[model samples]
Target: MEIRLFQLLVPGVALLFIAAVAVRYLKGKINLSEFLLSLIFWMGLGVFAIFPDNISVFVAKLFGIKDNVNAVLFLSIGVIVYLLFKLYAEIKENRRKLTLLTRKIALKDAEELDEL
Candidate 1:
């Protein structure tokens, strides 16, 4: 229960991840939603990792879970599912846009050929 190393390590890693996300967002590589999601995730992770006992016990009790570890696991699974869904949506949108762009380019090329 007393993970001393993680007490320091987790927050450090979380901060690094947050910084990376911020940098990407500022560079215009990622959108606002993506930035916010990543920021919230890392901040939550850092908070939970830093104060596992305090928060975990409350969450476990709230869910009627006997074990704090189980509560943490449940929340982690939920977060993973949410992120996966978001990723799927982004991929689907990108695919749709790419298909539309390809069709447009092909039509333009065909029109040019017909003119020639």
Candidate 2:
């Protein structure tokens, strides 16, 4: 079995990200759920990088995919779409909150001016 340069490099990068996430978590910069999610993602990335072929083959078989490449592509697309949906939802909630806050502030200012 021949080891490739990327197999080592990718895992090394993943470890660096994991360490960064741990430090942020310890410093209370991110919540517990965020920390755990980051940890799991980084760990999985490192493991997948180290065993891409084996994992891809397993995924292909598990999903009844005819080709490993196609399986990976589909999996990657699914993850991206899920993340996008989550981001969109967060943004929508933020916008709703901002609108409510703005309205409250505007009403308070109007009342103060009228009192003068």
Candidate 3:
């Protein structure tokens, strides 16, 4: 087994970085800052996954497993990831509609309401 310098930078740290972005995404916090962070997090994590080290190990631990657990962990993580995106999309769509409806009502313009 050969340990490389790049391995140290990736693995657990990188995946944790990805999880933070994903968490922010799931929370409907998709601003420019969030998007940029998510992009960087995923890109770095993706690049890191290529090496295979602590990330796989950390994921494996989720299943109360010791080895060869990447398959299960990966699937579970994928489902959660899919659900997170779906949630984000639904929330974003709702916010868009709310903004449009609120604009129509002119809640901020008290004079407009007086005419109704």
- Best-fitting candidate, measured by TM-score? 2
Clashing residue pairs, candidate 3? none
lDDT of 3 by residue, 17-107 (tens): 7777777777887676766756675675656455466555655676666674555467568868976997899999999999999987785
Candidate 3 regions exceeding 4 Å error are 1-32, 61-64, 71-115
Decoy 2 TM-score against native: 0.88
Backbone clash pairs for candidate 1 read none
Model 2 regions lying over 4 Å from their true place: none
> What clash count does candidate 1 reach?
0
Cα RMSD of all models vs. native, in order, equals: 2.4, 1.9, 8.2
Q: TM-score for all predictions?
A: 0.84, 0.88, 0.37
Candidate 3 versus the native: TM-score? 0.37
Please give, for residues 1-116, the per-residue lDDT of candidate 2 as tens digits: 68999899989999999999999999999999989988888888889889999999999999999999998899899878978997999999999999999999999998999953
lDDT of 1 by residue, 1-100 (tens): 6679888999999999999999999999999998998899899989988898989899999999999999989988998899899889989999999999
Better of 1 and 3 by lDDT: 1
